[model samples]
Structure formats: structure tokens, C-alpha cells
Target: MRRKARQQTKAENRPRFWGRHAVAAALDNPERRIVRMWLTREAAEFLVPPKDIPVTYAEAADLARLVPGDAPHQGAVAEVERLEDMLLADLLDQAEDGRPLLVLDQVTDPHNVGAILRSAAAFDALGIVTQDRHAPPESGALAKAASGALETVPWVRVVNLARALEEIAEAGFWRIGLTGDADTSLQEALGPKRVALVLGAEGEGMRQNTAAHCDALAKLPISGKMESLNVSNAAAIALYAARAAA
Candidate 1:
């Protein structure tokens, strides 16, 4: 019995994915080359496809090494290839489909960006537009928080956000700037067309010039209880409002 356990250990010792959703989604992707899987005994039996994908039973602590410290891996893990990035032009061209595009200007927090990506995917957005200088990269806790949303959403990073706004305007998108202090309510100001929701950092909100470039400035109708909502929270609310109106 001990030898059998040791043999199972040997088979399971390979690198495994630790996040359930990430691993589950990765397993679904034909592009993902999952090498191995490690699951808790109960979790092992719970997964479908009969764990036929080369799995080993593992203790929870053993799975921690693969995922971040705070992650809820749910006792399942898999090793997979990194996902790919989509070109900005491709994202732009796809805008013809009529879904609104989301533009982020200098919003640097990875967690916030990740949350926003999740929101963007939920809203059926065309893609996420971010400035190359300000946005976070694909890793860190950001991608993990985004979960599978990061893989699904196209992130376009441009050198100049102000200039990019100009390009978006040229593409016939109604650029709506979201701000806390603006006088107008977001829903009343928005047009039902291909829109580009321009957002910015939390503390600073939209930069003066970034705000200036927008075709219109809109504000979320919030009670004057606090100074501001977290950028991602505001973005989620705004995206929901837009989708509801559309």
C-alpha cells in the first residue's frame, strides 16, 4: 500500500495547474497542451472526463506551489502552455461587429485591470484598449484574478492613448468618458451606437487631456457618500449600464 502511494506520488509529481477555472478552461482549449493534472482524492473523483487526462491524487499543500499564495485552487491543477496575445489591429477590425470597445487610459493596477477584463468579457465588448505605458502585463496576480477572462479578452496597448482616442473617433465610435465629478448621468448621455468607453486611473480619474479628447463626458449617478469607487468597480457598473441601455 505504501509502495502504491509512492508510485502515485512519482506519477503526480510533475508540474500541475492549481486553479480550477483556469485549469478547466485550459483543458478545454485545443491550443493548451496540458502535460499533467493533480487533484485531491475527492476532487479527483469529482472531475468529469474520468480524470483520463493523466492525473495524480495530491494533498492541498502540494498544489500550492503551482498557484499564487491567496488563490482558491479547489484541489485541482494542470500544466499548460501560455496563452497568446491578439494584435490591436485585429481587435480594431473586429469592431465592425457592433459591440462597444473599452478603452483604459493609464489604469495601471493589475488586479483592477483583471477585474475590468472580466467585466469586458461579460459585456460582450469588442476588446480592451489600454495605453502601453500604463497597463499591467499578462502575469502577476492580474491574470489569475482575470481567470479565463484574460484569455478571452483582447488587450490592445497603444503608445499614445490620446492619439488612439482620435483613431477611435475616426472609426465612428462615440467616445464616452466616465468620471465621478461630471454633471451628466451616464445613461442619459450615451448614444446607442458603436461606443468606446474611455476610463482612467482611480485617484486622478481621466487626465485633463484624456478627458479633453473625449467626445463627451458622462458621470455615473452615485450618492455623494464617498469620493470615488475603485476604477474596476466603476468600470463594471459603467459596462453594465451600457449593456443594459443597448
Candidate 2:
């Protein structure tokens, strides 16, 4: 109980956002509760804040102090409140336009997940689904990689990925698992249907159980010399293909 309380406290206090795009997006998001903002002179000029939010002007070194060591903050940092999590059912119910959803299976790399979010936003995906226990939390590295997409895209974290996939399947989406050994190409497998592209971790790929939940497994056409592409790269390609097909 004490450990859970401490974790809740930690999550509540850890809203430090950095980087120009990340900070700018947080400021722009109407739902985001801005605690305070620290900016270098150059970054300050570009940001116009509401009267209620506090602003602090500082030097580049000072801005860097707000983030981890060696982080590229781009002279902007903001401490804001975390956005509320979206329920799987709620997201599915609200998804009337049939936008594609990206499901990540135990892909813990923050940079990769962030890049996936960026691509999802570019392709106008409905949202991203991740297992809460296995996925990375909101952090500067993730926001930096995502650019501004972290603010625009919804990330739905669930307890069980396989169960979540089942829920997704029931929501009228065709779950397409991306695996290198699959018999069909992505384009051939995806035939103008609402889709949820499920991708797993870097090397291990999707778990056997997760694959079993998928309606179909498909692969991208790549050189035989390369066994697999990076998960983020694969996701971007899949999103583009889905968009083009739609």
C-alpha cells in the first residue's frame, strides 16, 4: 500500500516537459493544466501564454536543468499535469470515423513508442494502445521524439494486451498483426477495412498469445538480407499503407 501511494505521488509530481515542440504543444492543448513554464529568451518570444499560467525566463543552462542531463530541451521546458487516460471502450465507442489504431505489445523503448505516436498522428490514427505494465510512462525523451504528437494523439494503456485486442476485435476493427514470417503482404491483407495494427517489441516480436488474438498476420515486402525492420519504421509503413488504401 505504501509503495502504491509513493508511486502515485511520483506520477503526480513528474510532469516536467521539455523541447520546443513538446512544450509548445502542451501550452497549446486546452486540456493540459500548465503548472509553470521555464523558457530561454529565444523560446520565450515564440510562446504566448494565458494570464493564469506562470512563466519564468532563464538561460539555456537553466532550461537544461529542468530536464535530464544531456537532454536537448531546445530552450523550453514546462511542468504540467498529466492528461487523463482514455478507456478502451470509450475510445472505441467514440471512434465513429473508423480511424486505424496502433497497438504496441510490450514495446518498452520510449523513443520507439514516441516515434510511433508521431507517425500515428501524421496518419490521423484513432489512438495507440499499450500495456500499462510494460510500456514506458510519459517522459521528456518520449515527448522529444514525438515532437508535438504527444499532445494531439491519445495513448490508451490497458492491463491485459490480449484481452484489449479481443475488445478491439469486438469493436469492428480487423486486427492485423505485423510479423516478418507472415504469408501475406500488408497491402493484400488489409482490404479497405477498419484496422488495428498490432506490433510487438524489437527482436522478440509479438507473443504467441497476442498473435493468436489477431484476425490476420501480415508482413511488409523487404529485402531478404534484412530479417526485420525496426518496430517504429514498420508502424510508419503500415500506417501509410492503411491510409493509402483507405
Index of the highest-TM-score prediction: 2
TM-score of every candidate = 0.79, 0.93
What are the clashing pairs of model 1?
17-77, 17-78
lDDT of 1 by residue, 45-146 (tens): 666533457777789888776677866788887754455555566677777534778988788888899899889889888888888778876553565567
Candidate that would win on lDDT: 2
> In model 1, which regions exceed 4 Å deviation?
1-17, 31-38, 44-57, 78-81, 96-98
Q: Candidate 2: misplaced stretches above 4 Å?
A: 1-12, 96-98
User: Which tens-of-lDDT digit does each residue in 1-246 have in candidate 2?
Assistant: 999999789667776888889988988899888888888888878887787889898999988777899899888888877888889998898664447899999999999999999999999999999999999898888888999899999899999999999999888899999999899999998974689999999899999999999999999999989989999999999999998887
RMSD of each candidate relative to the true structure:
7.3, 2.5
lDDT of 1 at 147: 75
Which 10-residue window in model 1 sums to the lowest lDDT? 10-19
